[model samples]
Target: MPILSKETKAAILGAIHLKTESVDVPEWGDGVTILVSEMSGLARDAFYAKKEGGKVPISQSQADLLLATVVDETGALVLDESDVASLQAQGTAVLDRVVAVAVRLNGMQPAAVEDAVKNSAAAPSGDSGSSSASTSASQ
Candidate 1:
C-alpha cells in the first residue's frame, strides 16, 4: 500500500513527532531488541539531521556503510536513492543499446524472409504462370 501522500505527510510527520520540536528517546534495556523501531528511528533521525544541518551531505561510501550497518545490525532494509538512480541509469543504457541492435537486425529481416517464404511455397516444377503454360513447360 502507498503510505506516503500529501495528505498523509503531515500525519506521518506528526506520528513520528518530527514537528514536535523535541526528541524523545524510547526506553532501551532488558535485552529488548526493538530492531525495526530502532533502525527506523535512526534512519528518520539521519534524514532529519541532514535537513537540520546537523550532519553533512552523506557520500556514496558513507551511504553504503549506513545502509549496511542498518541492515546488518538491526536487520532493517535501506535504500540509497541516488545509488538506485545510478543503477537505473545503467539499466536504461543497456536497454537502449539492445534496442539499437534489435532495430538494425529487424531492418535486415524483411527481404530475406519474403524471398524464403515465396521460394519455399513454389511448386515442384517451379511454375507460377498459367496452368496450360505450366503443363507445357513441365512436360
Candidate 2:
C-alpha cells in the first residue's frame, strides 16, 4: 500500500546533500534533522510513521529514529539495537501492533466527539414534546 519502497527511500535519503546547509535546528525541535527533497522527505516520513498503512500510529520518537536512519546512517537510533540486529541478522520479523490500535483510536475519537456534539445539539432544549416527537419519528 505504500507508494515508496525501502530502496526508494534509501536512495532518496542518500541523494540528499546535508553539507550545503548549516546544522540549524527548527524552532519546534522535532528531534530529527535531514537534508532531502521535500516530497521524498514527506513520503519517507509518512511511510516510517505508518501513515501509509491506515490505522497505524507511530510515536514521534520512533518516527524521528526512522527518519534519522533513512536520512543519515549515523543519525539513526534504535532502542532495541541488539534485538533488532539479531532479528535482521537471522532474517526474522518483528511486528509492533500497537500503532494500528492507536491510529484507529485516534480516528475514532474525533468522530465520537463530533457525534456527541451533534446529538446534544439536536436534542430539544427542555421540551418534552419535541423529544417525544423525535422518538416517535424513528418508530
Candidate 2 local lDDT, 1-82, one digit each (tens): 2234685777655554321111223432565343221123454354446544455323443333323332234432233333
Clashing pairs in 1: none
Candidate lDDT scores, in order, read 0.38, 0.36
**Each prediction's number of clashing residue pairs:** 0, 0
lDDT tens digits, residue span 10-120, model 1: 876665321111112132234432111123446544644554635543343234333322222324443455553442333334333333332233232467657756876
